[model samples]
Target: MITHIVLFKLKDGIDRDTKQVAEAVAYAREVGHQVPELVDWRVGWNTVDRDISYDFAAIGVLADLPALQRYQENDFHRLAIEKWRLISDWVVADLEDQ
Candidate 1:
């Protein structure tokens, strides 16, 4: 199995309380249900406050690399990502379970 993880920091001047931010978070949380290739999906706002911390996180599990690729290419996933792009800068990591 592969674990796909993403951390996002809101861009300058983007308010965390805005409707757009809420929509972005909701989209991230729901995309796993929308994309069949995603085996598990989890996303949330950060509760801890720290200077270096990201504002939000998304974690998902896929069966393999091809599954991960299919999730990325899924139309619903792409649209959700576009909404996130408008509000944040993010980083991602993918790991395979041993």
Candidate 2:
């Protein structure tokens, strides 16, 4: 299996309480149902308060690399990226799951 992880940080001068951020968060979670390749998914704001901690996190599990790629190219997945870009910058990592 593969785990696709994303960490999102609000952009400079952007606060987490705005309507844009709230909608993006809701959209991120909703995208899971729209993508067929995801075996599992979790999306939410970070719980801890720390400088090193990002504002949001999304973790998705897929069958393998090909499935992960399909998820990346999915229309809803792309839309979620577009939504996040308006309020924050994000980093992603894909890894094999034991």
Candidate 3:
């Protein structure tokens, strides 16, 4: 299995209100549920670590490279990536078993 984690730093001047943040997080979570290749998903808004420069983060789990590839190629993921890119800066890391 692999853990694919991403962090986002939203652009300047975007609203960070609770409702707005909640909506974004909800959308992020929804992506995984809609995509079969994603084993799990978790999205979080930057709260305690405001100075770290990222506004949001997501963690996704996949059983293997093929699963990850499928997730990447999915239309839903493409849309999510487009939407996310419009609002934030992002980073990703993929972890695997030894």
Candidate 4:
């Protein structure tokens, strides 16, 4: 299996408690539940506060690279990512779950 992970940092002046951010979070969570290629999904805000910490995280476990690609191409995944794209900067990593 492969683990796909993303971390997000909120843009300057963005407030996580606001309606927009909350809605984005809800939508992202739905994608976690709905994406077919993902064997497991987890997405949420980071629990710690520190200069080096990102504000949010999304993690997905899939069968392999093609499955990971399908997860990325899923429509809901695109929409959920667009929501955060407007409000934050993000980074990703993919790992082999051996």
Best-matching candidate per lDDT:
1
Question: Which ranges in model 1 have alpha carbons more than 4 Å from their true place?
Answer: none
Candidate 1 lDDT over 1-98, as tens digits, reads 99999999999999989999999988887897899998889988899989999999999999999999999999999999999999999999999999
The C-alpha local distance difference test score for the whole of candidate 3 amounts to 0.79
Please give each candidate's TM-score: 0.96, 0.94, 0.85, 0.95
Q: Is candidate 1 or candidate 2 better by TM-score?
A: 1
Clashes in each model (backbone N, CA, C under 3 Å)?
0, 0, 0, 0
For candidate 2, the per-residue lDDT at 30 reads 90
Candidate 4 segments exceeding 4 Å error: none
Worst 10 residues of 2 by lDDT: 16-25
Off by over 4 Å in 2: none
Q: Write the per-residue lDDT of candidate 3 for residues 1-98, one digit (tens) a residue.
A: 98999988877876666455555666787887888988888887767754766778889999999998998898877877877766677889999966
Q: What's model 3's lDDT at 77?
A: 79
Supply the TM-score for candidate 4: 0.95
Per-residue lDDT tens digits for candidate 2, residues 6-96, read: 9999999888888988888888999789999999999887888998989899999999999988988999888888989998988989999
Error of 1 at 65 (Å): 0.4
Better model by lDDT, 1 or 2?
Answer: 1
Model 4 clashing residue pairs (backbone): none
Query: In candidate 1, which residue pairs clash?
Result: none
Top TM-score prediction, candidate number: 1
- Candidate 1, after superposition: displacement of residue 79 in Å? 0.4
Q: lDDT per prediction?
A: 0.94, 0.89, 0.79, 0.90
